[model samples]
Target: MTTSTGKGSIVVVTGASTGIGASTARALSRHGFHVLAGVRRAGDGDTLRANGIEPVILDITEPTQVQALAARIAADPRPLHALVNNAGIQVNGPVETLPMAQWRRVFDVNLFGHVAITQTLLPALLRSEGRVINISSIGGKLAMPTYGAYAGAKFALEAVSDALRREVSPLGVEVVVIQPGGVRTQMAARGVATANHLAAQMTSDQETRYGGLVQAVNSLMDSGTASGVTSELAARVIVKAVMTPRPRTRYTVGRDAALLIRLARVLPDRALDHLSARSLRSHHPRTPTVGVLSRLRVGVSS
Candidate 1:
């Protein structure tokens, strides 16, 4: 698992408590990087350490933690080789009825958090000739009904990634975006809950127009929850992008990610939206399997 770059290279990965972040931490460790696995909770950090990783307390949404990470890495003499910004959350519902609070919550973590952490660590990255890997989603490229908040934030992230790549490439820093279609994670559960929460907050007429849509979205999340990519597989992709001599700017994962993105681009917005609605409806369950799918979606991956 060692690389020619040397085992002492320093790597910083955010949201290492679960899903892609946790998997990336372990994968990078196997590659011999001294990983500073960042997690919001101390208990989660302890779990990472138990698995042979060095855990650091970090919440990307917190300014102090982000600054501390920068300070600590800058003070250390070891070259900072990579930064994996993998922390994210999902919120789903009609944009019109979506609570402003929920919208802000999603963006705060998915967009602003990534930017804050990256900006804070940019100096170290420049000094080490390192790369920044943003763990975005297929939603960043395609818009679907009921995922307005989540998709909006990811869209912003992709734009920011594009800008950062241009801004930092001259400084010997690289920016890579990983756009995964569907990897089973807590994200789906959060999206579903957001749907219900938003529904409750809506007016009767608004709910009538969109309640079925939200339920359909939850159903689609359930049906699509089938065996997908594992976080380990995603981590492998990140490791390749980070360790490769000439990394690609964008990497798309999952079976349908590429096809869907292509379709979304070629098809008219209304057509694509209708298609997504149909797909959502087809996945909603009429039986007990619905419950299973919902639970499975909370942590399953592509």
Candidate 2:
């Protein structure tokens, strides 16, 4: 860990190699924060350094790397002002057929890894009265078919954030959740790849059982990606969560995110189900009859 004579409030942004995390690190640096951008690869570190942000080699899911990050920050003369847990992976597949390993991997990165980092950094954060900002997704609130693994992780993250907020508020450390609807990021591409790979791996019987539903869900995901907001927009929201005098407990970043949140809160379960099914139907009109029927069944069961 190299120490630098940097200026202003200090922040650590995990998964700063690309997408929202990278944008947030850059934005925070521009806003006068001495940003420590966490990356998993050496090349990514070079990229961040070239852009004038300090880079820390960190893979959040790796316990030793996470510990090294905490130790380095502790040793630094500058007080840590914020910790942003933005590192996450997406696993898109049917819930019934999704591998347990993939589910564990998603939760490890999205929820457990963040918890470990937060716990490790609490001392520094408490001393600085800093903030912990979690990057979640609109899927955190609304779960769609084939997005169960990612959404499940985010949902758990939200619950963890709420609990951490209540527990740490008295200590002057704030915990916030930023849920972005659909940000134009590498994550969407990764999700598409994951979905495609999973679809390819399915046996004939599994395909017959889950193929239409997966297609419907993938179509919905494509729609979200098409209308996604910019990563910089999400970064701005993150900066607000960190810099605001009295930070909000949660913020929905994109306009689409805000709308989805509103609908999730106001609409009854059946209404949401019907709307979701209809949207899926619009995409895969012919083959996804099973998808619609399954959705209706789930709605009725609920």
Candidate 3:
């Protein structure tokens, strides 16, 4: 799962406190690269510092911290091999129910933060012809009910990656996207917690419309995580994307992700809608949630 070809080189991985980011930092270290692992807390950074790995305090949303990371890398002697943009937050809510502030927060963490960090480090990457790896999700390809904000940010990330790839590939910098289905990472539990928190804030009428759906989605998320691939495996796929000489523009981490993304590419909108609804319906609340979306259809009966 590793190669020493990266000997003495440098790689940066964001959100390295736990899960895939943490695993990726270790894996790249094994491959002989000095890893700059980005964590939010000093405690987290402390835990991740060892061997070839050095953790940096990096809240990608904060311009100061991001610039600091860039400066640290710029001062280093090793050539930058790659930058893995793995930091993320998941906030699930229906488009009609999600507050604009929450929506912006999602984009800030999931999309804009990556853009800012990439912009900051492009000089080093251009100097080394290094790659940019973005950790996306199957949700980027197909949005589910109550996943409007999360999926919207991911979809935007996908587009940004595309634009970046086209803009930089000719200049020798590669931009790659990793879309994972259900990886057994801590993100699911965090996402469920956030979903419930947002659900609690909904208006009485909004709760009546979305509460059951929210519970169902949470249930499904739990099950998916239970059955998904391990974070170690997901990290290996990302490492593969980094080490491959001429990597694909996109690499999917799990079988579910590969299959679902392929389907999304070929299936019509109505067909995909039916598929997504069927998959989610099985996890619907024991209560009658079937009429939830129907309520949206039923406005003033003028």
Q: Rate the local accuracy (lDDT) of all candidates.
A: 0.80, 0.84, 0.89
> Once superposed on the true structure, which residue ranges of model 1 sit more than 4 Å away at CA?
1-6, 50-52, 284-302
In the range 14-104, model 1's lDDT, one tens digit per residue, is 9899888898899888878889999888999888884337788998998998888888887788888989999888778788877788889
Model 2, range 166-228, lDDT digits (tens) per residue?
A: 998998988999999988888887887687666766656677787777777777777888799
**For model 3, where is the 10-residue window of minimal lDDT?**
293-302
Please give, for residues 4-27, the per-residue lDDT of candidate 3 as tens digits: 278878999999999999999999
Rank ordering of all candidates by TM-score, starting from the highest: 3, 2, 1
Please tell me which predicted candidate would have the highest lDDT against the true structure: 3
Model 1 Cα shift for residue 247 (angstroms): 0.7
**Preferred candidate (TM-score higher): 2 or 3:** 3
lDDT, model 3, position 298: 45
Measured on C-alpha atoms, candidate 1 has an lDDT of 0.80
Query: What are the per-model numbers of colliding residue pairs?
Result: 5, 0, 0
Q: How many clashing pairs does model 3 include?
A: 0
Please provide TM-scores, in order, for all candidate models, with all chains considered together: 0.89, 0.90, 0.93
